[model samples]
Target: MTESVQAWFFLLLAFVGGVSAAAFSFRLLGYLAVSLRRPRDLRRRYGAWAVVTGPTSGIGRSVALKLARKGLNLVLLDLSAANLQETSDMIRSRHGVKTRTVVFDLSLVGTPQGDDSMRRLRAAIDGLDVGVLVNNAGVARPSVAYLHEADVELWVRMLKVNLWALTEVTAAVLPGMVERGRGAVLNMGSASSEAIPSFPLNTIYASTKRYVAKFSRSLYVEYRNKGIDVQCQVTHNQPISRPAFKFHQQE
Candidate 1:
């Protein structure tokens, strides 16, 4: 009996090790493939125009600029008209790519105004050879708070902007890509989606990010063979600006 138990333990260990090794190898290969891909390859596979949400500041702005540099015409969407115009001008000056700006608040989704906003967004992209969609518009509470302590309006807005807006925008754009047989969708996710390092205070934010991750995974599976690549980029927190020296100095 002792010998049989020892054999089963060793077999189980070997099986686990083999599975781990295979998973690691597959990930390594995928990374290598992405690194080797060229800008022209993306243009050929996807198309000429790329749509980016939240293109006013920080990471979203960075992504929009990079796509412009890759020779893709841009459709910039943001809540602030001034910031949208600024980003559009900068991209046009630097990359000389065509740019269109759509300014509307995503947090108002599911309302009559939101429906009108969606109609305007559709009009902005109409007749353009759009190929890439970046669902990057998101929001979080100003400070950490427990579930009961959180503001009800802020929580509702968070859901509206982060999940509902993403769904609606993707739905609006995906059918065109499907008909054309090529496109890519990039969704931004947070590291909080992982099981480790539980977020005690930012519970709602973490849950929303996890939803983005799962939504991207399922979409990828459903559209992989249809020439649409869906990816959820999981990111860790990074300082966007200098830390405030005093509590009153915080922006």
Candidate 2:
């Protein structure tokens, strides 16, 4: 082609590309603006007695603090005694709300009565009405780069903690919530469950989170009319990761 003709063709292509880019940028900016302007109050119509697992740090800590400030009695659980105590102290001192701590390994798949550590946890706090249950205890591992490098038992244990333990505790508290005809179950799930990524090693952990999200949604559909609110928080951004924090389903 002639130089003049080629130059004109390239110019046209650049113009189209610029227009497309500008359109995308405008849309993104508008979305961000709307998100920034929206109100974020929890909007609870009734009071609660909240239970938060993995309340030692990060999102769990924030959730616990928020509930405490909102005047909800808090039950904070973690495997770390120091962290659990710290959370309890913060809530009691700062918010002046009632706070209880249970430092037992919840990754084990049963009630506290079945295990000595858990029994102590139960014995410490009993005959109380728990209105909101936050099943937020979870972990990912020592970087299993290869399938063979992964410990099958450890993987199962993680599932037992992430899935089964949460289930048991919720089971223990659920009947009460139903009997009262009002309560909330907040499950901390991961966004990896929604869009399956190609990352190796984190597959099993991710799958467990996916199960949590699915379970929470299914429960909501079944029980929302009964005045029960089941909220699953699927977080995309974590403290250790480079992504932004968001929930798949937020109400």
Candidate 3:
């Protein structure tokens, strides 16, 4: 290649590298800014006790650690023993906050095991006023050819985990918060609930999330006067480290 062509290539590579470095630096700075501000913000806020379902990883795990660092004792719930123990250990060693792990599948309905699981959780956290409830335990079923082709059992399981289990666990902790006259309920929702144009393949999962949004909103309105705060966040993007599955909107 000619020297001019080589110089041009080198310049182009250098320009691309500079742009990439600048973007990364910007993100790092933004993260640092947020980190610096968070402690001051939490200092102004009262510490609260929290229960986080699906606290083993992803958004649930991040929220648990953040809240724990902000002085909230956590009750971590997940079906996986390894993930649950890892999260508990991280909270204890890093944040020095109390951590409890409960392993229970949220999909089975009207089961003795489910009821017993809740009872044990209540007993373990006995007397600690749970001021925050993060209902994040949800399961997603893979799409078949279409909504009709989706397994009926999968649909039912999704309802059990996303809707029924969320309700049961929230109900278990909420009464105490109401009695104490202060608490927050954060329910994980989805853009699919707002009728987003995701594939209809996941219709059942979307419908269950819609019910969660509606139920959470109604509970918020109903219990606001009793000093309960209910906030529903519609989560859309999963991290790149996870699988890249997309769904179109349902009819």
How should the candidates be ordered by lDDT, best one leading?
1, 3, 2
lDDT of 1 by residue, 45-94 (tens): 68899889998887788888878877889999898999999889999999
Residue-by-residue lDDT tens digits, candidate 3, 47-96: 25788999887778777877877788898888888989988998899988
How high is the CA lDDT of each candidate model? 0.80, 0.71, 0.74
Pairs clashing within candidate 3: 197-249, 198-247, 198-248, 198-249, 199-247, 199-248, 199-249
Better of 2 and 3 by lDDT: 3
The per-residue C-alpha lDDT of model 1 at residue 108 equals: 87
TM-score of candidate 3 on Cα atoms, chains taken together: 0.74
Task: Specify the highest-lDDT model's number.
Answer: 1
Off by over 4 Å in 3: 1-47, 195-199, 236-251
Which pairs of residues collide in candidate 2? Answer: 107-161, 112-118, 112-119
What are the per-model C-alpha RMSD values against the true structure? 8.1, 6.0, 9.8
Model 3 residue 186 lDDT score: 78
TM-score of each: 0.81, 0.72, 0.74
Query: What shift in Å separates residue 207 of candidate 3 from its native position after superposition?
Result: 0.4
What's the lDDT for candidate 3? 0.74
Q: After superposition, how far is residue 246 of candidate 3 from its true place, in Å?
A: 25
